[model samples]
Target: MTPDHEVLVIGAGFSGIGAALGLRRAGIDDFVILEERDDVGGSWYANTYPGVAVDISAFSYSFAAEPFASWSRVFPPGEELKAYADHCIDAYALRPHLRFNSRVKRASYSESAHVWTVVLGDGTALTARFVICATGWLTKPKTPAIAGLDTFKGDLVHTAQWDRSLDLDGKRVGVIGTGASAVQIVPEIAERTERLHVYQRTPTWLLPKPDFAVPESVRRLFRRVPATQRTIRLLTDVVTELSFVIAMVHYRRFPFLAKAGEAASKLYLRRQVKGDRTLMRKLTPSYRVGCKRPSLSKGYWRTFTRDHVELVTEPIEEITPSGIRTADGEEQDLDVLILATGFHVLDNLPPFPMRGQGGRDLKEFWKTERFQTYEGTSIKGYPNLWFIVGPYSFTGGSWFGMIDYQVTHALRVIGEARRRRATEAVVRPEKHDRSFRRNLRRMRNTVFLDPSCRGTHSYYLDEHGDAPAVRPASTYEAAWRARHFDLDDYSYER
Candidate 1:
């Protein structure tokens, strides 16, 4: 039996959008983009908390092929990103092909038919010759396992699912988790709230984000001469490569680089606190700079210095109806509670169920055998399946870089399969094993392996004591290998 479509892209996020564009550019269009949300933009669309913005520079965060020259700030806000996603969908005419509110329930592969049957939440099943899982790592928000959390009578919200209608003005608010989201949210709400208590389980490495409005002349220059924007992107990529990618990827060979980064961060924090050694110490991270994802902020540090804002370092005992009780038995009454506890990384990489090849479950395989993937895209037993953001797929850089490279890699294999009139394409077991081993070997030199990362509970490292979230290579390498990797690594069958 023939499949319903040639391909089925399982998200409408940047990754899925990239896959759709890749298929279109390869002169193939018989595909659909499935989204659980009511609209496009994925995380950017879902996350609209106050002061939300791209953590990285605006230029690097965007696609190279379609440069957005009219960003209002150096680190563009969440709304701009939402607008950008819409712009891409409109520009590529990807609307008709998108099925929003279509949540994938499970996907099963048929060995005999060499096709994938994707079951949606509403019980509708669609078949496709190939399936690309682009439901990214941030799809699932994680709520803390604090006791009595549900009993809290105050309005509660996760940073991922913010309700704009909920009011915080002149109300006592408690924010949990000092991860990326809290770094942005704390400053925005500190001044507005009657009293703000930032509960910090772990202090994240804070870097100075030089954020400012883009002058009209600069935007005009970028629009008039596209090369200028490209040049800025190039510079930003290089700086990111030097500062972050290199320090983490080659931490063993260049231990000082990570140390230097940490020292610089400490200095920045000290200066921000105006030599208030007590406040500086409270905000200092115990782990290496690159262990957990560090956050960039201009006001995150200053917000803590505000008289109305108090940083709570005590362990949270439980949530009372009035507020949160700490280990010391101190309870702070709150009118609102915000869980900025971040997302489930490895546990929700695919964000759904998948069965491939002779009733083999993908989640069970990973649970028993550890998370592994061929070039962070394909698995051996999962035929005709590609992950735009799979285990070990994210090389340290702007997410757009990872998306573009992975898209190119998947499209190349799909293009080759079509050229051969093949019914299925799967990575050879040996090639897949070799790639997995190579990743493990290279990861030994990275910061994740450093002793300081122990008990850090970084989302980067999975349960298997392996950092499967990172590709352990520079973005340039990822880009190059994506375009030039051996096609023979995959076994195409007619």
Candidate 2:
């Protein structure tokens, strides 16, 4: 039996778009991109809160193939990223193959037919010869289970699902979770809100964001000569890889890099807070740098110094009808409650039921055996299935670089399978295990294992105490391996 589509891509984000482009390059046309929302730009579409922008430099954050020439700032805002996504879709004519508002419920592999049956939320089932999961790491929003949260009468909003119509000009607002989203949102709303109460569980390491408007002349120059932009992109990529990526991945070899990062962060924070020891003590994180992902912002630190803005370090006990009650018995009244809580990283690896050969559930397998993937794309039993973002997949650089290399890896396997006229392609169990072991060994050298990171509650470390979210190798190594990995590692069957 033949499948309905040759490939079923599980998202329309940058990852899925990259996969689509990869498919086009490989001359494979029978594919469909299933996006859950009624639009493209996965995270960028969902997050539209105040001060939303890319933390990384725009030059490095975007795709290398389709360089964006008209960025307003060094760190472009969310809408610009969304526009770039739109540009890619239009340029590649990917809209025809995209199915919006199509949420996948589950996927099951068939041994006899060598195909996958992917069921939608409404029970619409579609069969595909291959399935590529590009449902990104930050898809599902994490909401805390605080007591009396449901009973709160005020307007409650999560940063991931911001209400654009709601007015916050003079409202008393309480924001929780000082993650990346909060770091951006708090500063934007602080001056506007009547009384902005920022509840902090733990402080984050912050670096000074070098954000500035890109001149029209520079944009024109970039447009006129693409080499200039490429040069900047290359420089940014190299600097980020050396300064941040190498420090995290090769922590054992260069522990001083992380130390220097911590020193720089502290110095920047001190300068921002202007020697306010009380505020500084409350804002400083106890964990090692890179234990939790650090953020970049010019205004996040100084937001706490405002007279109207209060940084509540007391643990939250429960939510009252009118306000939040802290453990210290202080009740802060507010008209708006914002959850800046981050996304579900490890728990929602797939965010849906997935069954492989012999009815092996993917989540169950990971829960029991720890999250394992061969080169962060293919699994041992899950034939013809690949993940653009999988365990140990992210290389701590730009999202586009991750998408590019992972797409290259997945498409290479799929392309070879097509060339061989094979119906199934699964990584050998031994090969998958070897990769997993390699990840485990390399992860020990990282800062995640340091004693200082013990109680930080970092999203990078999984339940198994492994930092599977980050690829232990550099981006260059990842790209090289994606292109040169042995094809024989995957067993292809007709």
The 10-residue segment of model 2 with minimum total lDDT is: 455-464
TM-score of each candidate structure, all chains considered together: 0.99, 0.99
lDDT per residue as tens, model 1, 135-163 = 98888999899999999999999999999
Off by over 4 Å in 1: none
Clashes of each: 0, 1
Residue 221's lDDT in candidate 1: 96
Name the top lDDT candidate: 2
- What is the C-alpha local distance difference test score of candidate 1? 0.91
